[model samples]
Target chain A: MKATGAYEPIFAGERRKRLDDVFTCYPTKRAALLPALWIVQQTHGWISDEAMTEVGQVLGVTAAYVKGVVTFYTMYHQHPVGRHFIQVCTTTPCNLCGAEGVVEAILEHTGCGDLGATSADGRFTVIEVECLGACGFPTAVMVDDDFIEGVTVDGVPELLGRYP
Target chain B: MGYPHEPHPKETLILSKHFGDAGARSYDGWVKCGGYQALKRALAMDPADVIEIVKESGLRGRGGAGFPTGLKWSFMPKERRKPHYLCCNADESEPGTFKDREIMRWTPHALIEGCAIAQHAIQAEVCYIYIRGEFTEPIAIMQAALDEAYREGVLGGNAMGTNRRIDMYIHRGAGAYICGEETALMNSIEGRRGNPRIRPPFPAQQGVFGMPTTINNVETLVSVLPVLNEGAEWYKDLSLGNPKSTGTKLFSVCGHVRKPGNYEVTMGFPLGELVNDLCGGMRDGRTLKACIPGGSSVPILNREETEACLLDYEGCVEQGTMLGSGGVIVFDDSADMVYQIMRLARFYAHESCAQCTQCREGTAWTVRILERILRGEGEMKDLDLLLDLSEQMTGKTICVLSDSCAAPIVSGIKKFRDEFEAYITGAKQPVAALT
Candidate 1:
């Protein structure tokens, strides 16, 4: 749940440059929060208020303005996620395809059920969410931005193996 | 396909047989089906008459808001300065809704032709299709279709050899549900945070780079092509009942069903028939416990309400909810209401757009309380607290995101109190009790 050394590089020169690139497009600085948060999330793996504050300062916006954009969308991570963040789609379509079984397998494997909860070994964190928008490929889970579809209970280990 | 034998309901501007061909996509394919002829015909008529035709069609917004499309178009001041814009809100992120995606993938030309007609109607020179970033493939497909239209003189300068020159572009959102909202979508298209703007001058008055603009959903505009071709009366009779809400709705049925996909059914079909017949009912002989008539935003309907309810705008309103986005999510007997609520609470908590203090703090509170109840650490007071917080969150924001998140929880707890109470009392009950 805490920021680690692996994520420290995100606050460095290149990430800030990417954040700067996103900021220049908006007429006002505050409008850059969502895209800045996305870049920070991509580099740091999650967004902290500190990261949000940094983004606010860089974009010449208030921390409150940055926080508002960060929390609005489900995709942004506010806290430290596991090395691999597994988002299992439990929306109507994926649920019909036995998304519950995928959730069960994930919980059994990770020993954590809460969103943003890292496993004891810091391997993975499982979050159940609404539709990921790939309804045709039902029972889909996004493992660190890559979608694995038609997931079954038996496929948990293999799905996790690709990450760690 | 033996899907169902339900009679086709009345038609409207959007659901006419003009582009109903399942395999319709190419510019030639659409032209063969009499597509951009509406745009050409519309270009020849006075722009006001084009708006009049839409007004005569009684076409309501197919997006969740259901605002009158003609009225929305009319809001754009004709005397406004140059560079009026038309934005197609293709950012379909509602939990159970997938109708737009199918249209984009299978009938891209329908959407393009509709956009052309809409641009001609509004006298807008530029159109932007703000698609969700998650729709990677669909966006590419749409872009390709735009290219094809340009190549064939269907789009871009001198569209179909007319004096009106309208160009279209596709801009993708990184990932934000609120961007599905019109104002937020304009912001996203303008390369800004997708947080919604306060409305006084609605998008019609001031939108997209501070010019007069009109935003319509993909399905809503696509329906226009058929309306202009077949006339308002022909389109109006497509629905089974309800003149206000006429047309075949693409109901995306999901959860606990044997046959779950986009089933286009006319308005006023019984919810029971849609599920039992079109959706082939619940799988494994399980009984239906509850249903979310629309997307995650609508109130959950208990089995009796679900069975008796009709699938239409007025029908759902009569049952104390709106037919929002036509996302029918069915839950079976084994489903856990407490856990389900917790999931919904978490989603709202994650997606609060945290601008206002009430939404930010209240959504987190709702999530915490729901999590406590689901974890069996809840007290009776927690339920009251949850309701109180949800009440405070509603109607206290710049956008309806707050209300959309709160409406279902307040209704869910009120209608399914026994389920919450059972979690508190630790009692064993029948599968039907929670629903």
Candidate 2:
């Protein structure tokens, strides 16, 4: 089973070491699915079906077991996205601050809404999400991984324009 | 221009009356301000009386569940052989909810004092604060306050010279949202994976090493301190709305609004006034599109319905949604229902504890279908499937997380089916998802 992706070599050895540490942390190997998926996603940008199967094998569980976890949570992405994954907070707190407009602005600029879809030019993929714990800064969106607070419809183009 | 800042509609609750410097987690500072007097008053009364007082005050759990605080405390098995436990759920992970963190950050003593009162009432010898791992700074603040309590002979064994003994400790979770669920929080405190357990043996009966446990949210517990001090009558009068729902609630308003911060407002206040007047109206003069009155878990409210909705628990329920954690997210005209549903689905998909098969698979299915639709690759049947899957997922899990995830998808489709249909026809892309 060609479980390893092309990007695996970048952190293959380190991933293996982290996998071992994860096993030691938990009494049961099956419990390590989340942390292991995090490590793989950090290394590969997203979790592929192949990566899930590989993680299941290393943890002595079934591919279905890992897939159940990977798919259940929003943090893990299955397909590749843009170099920068922009997740705007569309939940109630952020929505009150024009989170929807900020999302619209990003989508208009990027042309992709799902987590894995990239823009035609491969610049960005805008994913609208619930609250990001920064409700104080409403209409907040996380660019790549850093939170960009107080984003508005007009401010979105200026923000993304700088990324490329 | 930057978003406008609205002054708090009411005075701060636990953060009120800081006599000295802003940073006062020390025992001496809290004592000078009459901190543990409530604990003294609580200990002097019959434990049953304390419970009765809270029950009479109509204080609901500030935790997302909104269960009756007094009723929850009274659930302890009186004849249970093992010692009862009070687990303070400081694991505040809900997306728009941050009131607990602010309480812990500003008035850690309020939580510590609240824990002492709960321990006395429940007759529990030990209490543990289960905080989220990401709250590194707030955890330190809690620890310092706890340590000061210990130094002053207030926390460990024979707290405040009462015959009863209560000890408090801090346990940090490894960042799982499910841990916010009471049973899952108990499991994590016991050093297990943060997966939720089934109710009916609800934490009140068997919890934390097979002993009786009562889990209370940080804000809920802190509210008790003042309720005990000023008496239940004062708390009941603090409400600006229905008598059943008393006291002030910290409404965390965000999105599209000019001022988006935590505003403590009386229950039953008009939603329109709070949004347009309090939040300084929608930014850039955009038209209001929709809103999620509570946290993301509750159903979304369209512009017409939300305009009439009030910022209280009953008001929201009357409008076919809930005041879940009081996280109000607003949206403007540029907002797209299709993209909004997809984003919310992704959050539920990511946070499912995976204990129950239905919630485990159902959340993922919701996200996958939403992902396909947002990609402009949706079929008409997919919308029906999204609704069907959401129905299957609700109330069929160990925790409410499943229902929380499914509610938005069901509501999103019900309220915005046209948006989904429009996407299929390739007529107009939602402004929010227009890339």
Candidate 3:
């Protein structure tokens, strides 16, 4: 493999120690892959090909294998996203409670234009997610770590305002 | 207790007695509420005797499959050559289900105690509570509770001052609904893609790390505490004369209801009363039209069927649906059945691991056909195509996900054919946008 540009490694010094700490929780080193990827995602908003390679090297798994696990789950971002990532629930239960309209409202307010795309300002990226498991409070939206429930079309603007 | 509301008089609260109580989440608070006494008592008894008590209680798996909880534990070999494992499935990603989230959030110690009890019963040293990534608050709360438990000697090398070793850890799932499946969950823990494996050697035989494992739902494991304390006969008697289904279940009611939250009721509770009285009925003057009594996977029930239904495994089966996870989704007269069913198909399509051809192509095509109908671009032939496609999707995949996707499609077409016809006939306006 040839190096394209300067690629900073994630697991080093204190970061490597953190990965080792995660390793103690699991019986196998391969079981630390999920937590390892989470550490990468927390440090860097998205996972790049280089980061996958680094994770594979540290966990003794292949890069292709790491990518396979990453792509299988929807939470990991392959590319960079906006500062505030918003995921609105639009499953059957949420849809019955006008969740689609909330999605439209979120797009219109965030200026993200569509689902899975970030706004030109790079401040917001809104996407539709399947059930955030807070269906009792319908139209649950997750802005980063904040799980806001019972959101309505009118609440989109106020919700986005607080995020900014 | 109905989480966001006060406890109803009709409710039989055992596992959910401390749902909204913040104090119950702490280690000391849990002991104050009589928590670890069950674990202490169980650790002294023979593991076989513990399994027998649970079996006598008639507790079934709360996570969709109504398998006997004790029978699942008893499957573990008496002489454990390899390590035994216990996995508590906290991945509550089913569309209408949010009860497990509450269980971890408010009553974290209850789940911890339950897992400890289950670990001893199954002869497992380590228990992994697999929680989904989206539950950030519950994860934080549960992690803090675990730390406190370790500090207080509730869980450690010598758990509860006993000679046995008991260790518990939280394994966070990234974002996959299919990981809620038992086999798929084991695969996920092994750092593999979340796909359901073909089972010949089930989890109990060859499971996570190739060890004997017994996986129980968050609710099922937590119920063990009450059963141990109050006795299995008392727990069994909580049922409304339903010998097959015992104990109270937490029904996470959502959509088109007055009070949308988690409600705990005894087995064989009246579904209509749960909706009308407990949930405050269909949100003021809005008439109920349809309901998915179980989670999103089960067949949808029409108004009359929903009213006639009972909140139990056998009762739900009698009404042409299964009590899956007890995630009751209500729909009112204003809801468009065609559009809602399309949304459900899209969820299954998104969540499919795509390991099987039927699920991969079938879920995608199901969504496409449903979208066409919702867009009013479908013909009468499309419905037949959907029915035919659904037949192929069911019972063909390694997992029931494909069949789950087909349940509502087949049931919706059968019970609410007029809704589909209205969209095709241009009697109803197109609601879904074409991508």
| TM-score of chain A, every prediction, order shown | 0.85, 0.85, 0.95
Among these predictions, the greatest lDDT belongs to 3
lDDT of 3 by residue, B1-435 (tens): 898899999988888889888888888889999989999889999999999999999999999999999999999999978899999999999989999999999999999999999999889999999999999999999999999999998889978988678889999999999999999999999899999989888999999999999989999989899899999999999999899999999999999999999999999998999998999999869999999988999999999999999989999999999999999999999988888898899999999999999999999999999988888899999999999999999999899999999999999999999999998999988874663
Candidate 2, residue A141: Cα displacement in angstroms equals 9.6
Ranking by lDDT: 3, 1, 2
All models, DockQ values? 0.24, 0.20, 0.86
lDDT of 1 by residue, B142-242 (tens): 98899899998888778888855878877667667778889989887764667789987787778888878899999899878767888877667777778
The iRMS of the candidates, in order, is 3.9, 5.5, 0.7
The global C-alpha lDDT for each of the candidates, from Candidate 1 onward, is 0.76, 0.75, 0.92
State the weakest 10-residue window (summed lDDT) of model 2 chain A: A1-10
**Candidate number with the higher lDDT (1 or 3):** 3
Clashing pairs in 3: none
Regions of candidate 3 where Cα sits further than 4 Å from its true position: A1-5
Task: Tell me the docking grade of candidate 3.
Answer: high
Candidate 1: tens digits of C-alpha lDDT, residues A35-152: 6666777777888877777777777778887777666556777877788888888765576567877898888877776656889888888887767765534687878757565688
